[model samples]
Target: MNKLILSAAALALMAGAATADTVRMGTEGAYPPYNFIDDDGEVAGFEREVGDELCARAELTCEWVTNEWDTIIPNLVSGNYDTIIAGMSITDERDEVIDFTQNYYPPTASAYATLTEGADMMGGVIAAQTSTIQAGYVAETGATLVEFATLDDTIAAVKNGEVDGVFADKDALVPFVEEQGFMFAGDDVPLGGGIGLGVRESDTELKDKFNAAIDSMKADGSLNALLVKYFGDETAQY
Candidate 1:
């Protein structure tokens, strides 16, 4: 009789907690095609679209919140937001601090953008956004790593010759390479598992809901359509 009572109570708690509150989707609104602040000063990008759909699928009310990339995780942990839907790659190092849902974006490569060809990739001074995987990789490559608060600063460092190269996501570098004539230096370095929604470790129920939504999108092919829509035809799909 006691065991039956406890189980029923647990189930009741779970039911009541479903969609408990409005989930705040946190992101760095500077990474284009992922998340960005548009001309109207509102969050507008692939992540905004995906996040809204996920909330609908999960039956949760949601809101958008933008934060600086360097402080995004800390603010999430501090309850400034409920989830990190930014284009954040999952890694073992970060997983220690917070929990991640199943990957939404596929694994991609980090590349070096230099003004000239044949720039020394391994030993050259490189600029990368602070607190990023690219910054960590640059520090490990026997190169002097210059950290910047934003991606634009890294690209500017490259143009002004403050650094020999700037290392970042290949998708992000594509525009500069095509328009500004920055050439890729050295081989592309594959890093991280993939991109995922991040939530506090204690928010397992919230995580599960998002995981289910991602699975649904992947199963129905809507996720791949979004990828191609924002990242172009050649981008890796679900």
Candidate 2:
């Protein structure tokens, strides 16, 4: 009887271990304030904290991994990652490819310019990464769009006069130019969208859990607290 009872307990322990929830989250660590690496080689940013909170709420373990922004979606689809927690904007175009949790961050677009003067460059030559929402804006506004592989290169093009302006996530670009003394042309251009957590199409259960967690965080003001921690109180409006 003792031997049989021991076997049953061992089997139960194994099943519990196998069912433990784990959420593998991907992010573009290059985007500071949103997702970035710290001096100690730890992933530290608003998104990272938010991911941790969500995992706790859902009773899961989160694994953070840095991925190139452009390849994030592909990696999720290929099962290289379970979800994307980067500062990814939700758009009709992207909805066709993967599922998204309810918006965790509001999306806003802005332009950075070297001249800081007259010229509606929103319709002129603008630098952006290919297949990004910024690139879509370039297409819609008929801007002569310059596509680059990285944000640094695109920002460099703006500083070098290769492009009239560069459009990107307002949160990501504003603090950067302010620190670097690069001039911004206009007020915060409202893209009037929202950032979402991306999940594979087959992972609807995980997506639902994340959405619930986000809602709970928003209600408890934890989301706003994180925003202020990273972007300052006034700039945390989004």
Candidate 3:
């Protein structure tokens, strides 16, 4: 009889917890390693793993939503989702629009890739995905900047001779270089202050929960494990 009472109480508590909070995790499912829709049509990758773990640690229910990169922040502000678990960098400009949790991914390098060695990175035409840090960096290089709607399109431009090179995250370009005969051109240009979860400015309580979860992951070494699992040890330096 005592066991039955305890079981009933456990069930009631679980039900109540389930009804507590369900933060929507928004991401650009196009970005590989960071977040992507796997062959199973479910969100998978580093961010997905980390985000789900954070939710678990915080004891908060969560769901995933995919959005385009360009309009992601706008949609977040408009309440299309509760949090952005995308590989978005924490910047002062962005911080003005929406608050950010402590960084989950350390700052990584942006690099240029081209089919030809010693390609003119100075005044040559370069392709960059719109609204990315790479795009802005390329613009400052005195190179003609060609904007693409997607990362794949930017790479395609490089192969098609429409652009002299493509600028993007170095790790994201690894597969392309191996498969497409492209070589890393010039030095790796460092950009962004590191990636973090974006939350609405009004959602201070939600941000606190996520920050606590992030802290726990860091303390337990789970965050570093996830980063190294996707990226290499160099990026896992936290």
Candidate 4:
């Protein structure tokens, strides 16, 4: 849920319930380890596995659909998909436009990754994906915020010296720091409530079904296992 503006009440009038035989699950299939396209040209990531299980538990037939992250919520409102299973953090600004299930992913921290150690994270130019919480934070916290369409672009910015560092999910940045020689420049910044499934307000039934599935996963400890599977042992769990 990026920078969407429609109110939930208005969106309720625009979007219908999931009346199709196959519910379309929307995602930005670009953010690795969360949701991303794989070698076989299919959506394959933590969200994909979790979504399939949720659909099975809810007895809902579901399929995946890819969309640009910046427009994912708006397209949902326009009836492009039935649910958003992307790694979208629940926040009040987004809640105003769409409904969210109880968090499936635990709250995590955002961090800065720089090419060199001890880069001035707060005072120097920073890159973050457009319409993301990290971008908003950079814009508000006095850093010159340069945003891109994809997470890869932000990382490239850091590599090419286009910016001082890239601010993004710590989990998402770990691989770059360890393998690409980028160094974390500052303390992690905890933002958002947690990650959840997004739906139009009118689809209360769909929301309830996903929430129940998430609850069952949490109760059974399978959700934590999946989190650990993708994010490693140090990842925060339920």
- TM-score for each model: 0.90, 0.85, 0.89, 0.91
Cα lDDT tens digits, model 2, 65-181, are 888887889999998889898888887778889999998876555554544466467667888876677777677876788898777778888778888878777667866567776
Alpha carbon lDDT of residue 102, candidate 3?
Answer: 89
Off by over 4 Å in 1: 1-19
TM-score of 3: 0.89
Q: Decide which is better by TM-score, 2 or 3.
A: 3
For candidate 1, write residues 126-174 as lDDT tens digits.
Answer: 9999999999999998899999988899999998999999999998898
Badly placed stretches (over 4 Å) of model 2 are: 1-20, 236-238
**lDDT by residue for model 4 over 1-238, one digit each (tens)?**
3335457655665554444446899999999889999999999999999999999999988889999999999999999999998889999999999999999999999999999777888899999999888888899987899999999999999999999999999999998988999988878899999999999999998899899999999999999999999999999999
| Model 1 TM-score relative to the real fold | 0.90
Report lDDT (Cα) of residue 30, candidate 3.
Answer: 87
Residue-pair clashes per candidate, as listed?
0, 0, 0, 0
Q: Give the TM-score ranking, best first.
A: 4, 1, 3, 2
Candidate 1 weakest ten by summed lDDT? 13-22
TM match of model 4 to true structure:
0.91
Clashes of 1: 0
lDDT of each: 0.92, 0.80, 0.90, 0.92
Q: Superposing all C-alpha atoms, what RMSD in Å does each candidate have to the true structure? A: 5.0, 3.9, 6.0, 8.4
Compose the digit string of candidate 3's lDDT tens values, residues 91-200.
88899999999899888888999999989987899999998888888888899999998888998898899999999999889878887799998889888888999999
Candidate 1 local Cα displacement, residue 169, angstroms: 1.0
